[model samples]
Target: MHKSFSLQMGDKTLELGPKPLVMGILNATPDSFSDGGDHNHVADAVAQATRMVEAGADIIDVGGESTRPGANEVGAQVELDRVMPVLDALQEAKIGKPVSIDTYKAVVGHQAIQAGATIINDVWGFQRDPELADVAAHYNTPSILMHWDPNRDTSKDIVSEMKRYFNKSVQIAEDAGLIKGQILLDPGFGFGKNYEENFTLLNRIDEICALGYPVLVGFSRKSSLGKLLGVEPKERVAATGATTLLAYTKGAHIFRVHDVRENYDALQVAHATIYGPPPAKDI
Candidate 1:
């Protein structure tokens, strides 16, 4: 069984537990691998966030820059321009869900927190910019440190290397004053891993869960799924839901996904089967 964690984000608390939490992806970039240009404007982004929350998302993850392979890296100011307005609008809308800023840049992460983001999701695993951990620690925000190494040697044992990378990231967070509860680890399913390596990581993800931090997995519309199923990005919702069920059984605690309702439904069924149905609520 997976462990539960209470992530304190300002006045909001996310109870990530045995019935994994869903983090809806809200990319405000024009060139993300999937769902780009769909919500670049402030109003559109807010609407999508609202929809995700209503669809049962426990958190909304907002990203300004696309991290797809070979995507051009934008300057800090450009990224800030794209993200700050959306953050402001979401905060004003009172979305009633925690917002996580998906950024590896320290400047963007810092300002995003000040603008009302409660979580720092660093795709670079606090290894890109040293100050990003400091920013997360400064605000005492829950940080998702994702494993990403473009130069990772594929011949070596991938899970072992990932464990080492996570150890380093955990040390960095601790050095920056982040406690164990404020940190979460993501295996970065698609990033830096070849098709075979992605599957291997998933197969052995229980080893990662044994590290004792909540594991967040993101396999939504990934090219790996397309390669496996010969479908386009938008058509891979079923494939994504398959991974959600598999990963949840492997002890993952959070799922970062684009199709919130579909993934949420999949999790509900899995949870009911494994843990029994939750106590019914009153009308």
Candidate 2:
């Protein structure tokens, strides 16, 4: 049987698991490390999302703010302006996939859900804004809670720290009335983790996956990969693919990525090679 988790986002139902879910990255900010201002315009954003869907992206993660280390924060209105048009255009175009809002502000989360987004991919893990959990609960939608620390640095033993963070975030989500299956957790690959620490976490991701909620891994073009391959952000596609395979073996069910088609194609081959075709019993 396929491991399944149900996420009710507005009028859509996302059945995630068994097979890996690929979330394509779409940033509307002008300063994101990759594909930032490229998708700021409504037409461009819609086109890019459409292309990702065609490329096998299960979800398109739309973010208005740049979360790369040392990125300057934008106000909620700016974030809203950056994301709303894309959300509107995507829905208007009938993209036939869930649009996850990459945000932490409660107002933006609420507005994004109201504007047709179904998931909140909060990097702060709902700790930055407590109301974020409430927004997810209110919409009966799911939110992606990433692991974080008090100092917000992954310089130490981040695996243990990530477990504790996931525990707390899960409690908060449940307390806010999100059902058991409506919460998703991410290991937050490079959010605060250093080069080695990021790999350590990825290697031991099953520790987080054991928590029961679906695990989302965002290793796309992360600096850790760059540092490992000694390449720049633009050259991390192969590195990202390697990590995607490693993460799946470690029980990651969702992958947040930049190069969707490459990662998707990589996963297809990896899955078939490892698990063989779907059971002949199914046919």
Judged by TM-score, which candidate is best? 1
Candidate 1 TM-score versus the reference: 0.97
lDDT of each residue in 1-283, candidate 1, tens digit only: 9888888888777787787799999999999998989999999999999999999998999999999988999999999999999999998999998889999999999999999999999999999997999998899999999999878777789998898899999999999999999899999988999898888888888999999899999999999999998999999999999999999999999999999999999999999999999888799
Candidate 1: stretches off by over 4 Å? 279-283
The local distance difference test score of model 1 is: 0.93
Regions of model 2 farther than 4 Å from truth:
1-3, 150-156, 278-283
* Cα RMSD for predicted model 2: 2.8
Alpha-carbon lDDT, every model: 0.93, 0.86
Q: 93, model 1: CA deviation in Å?
A: 0.7
lDDT of 2 by residue, 61-98 (tens): 99999988888988999999889888988889999888
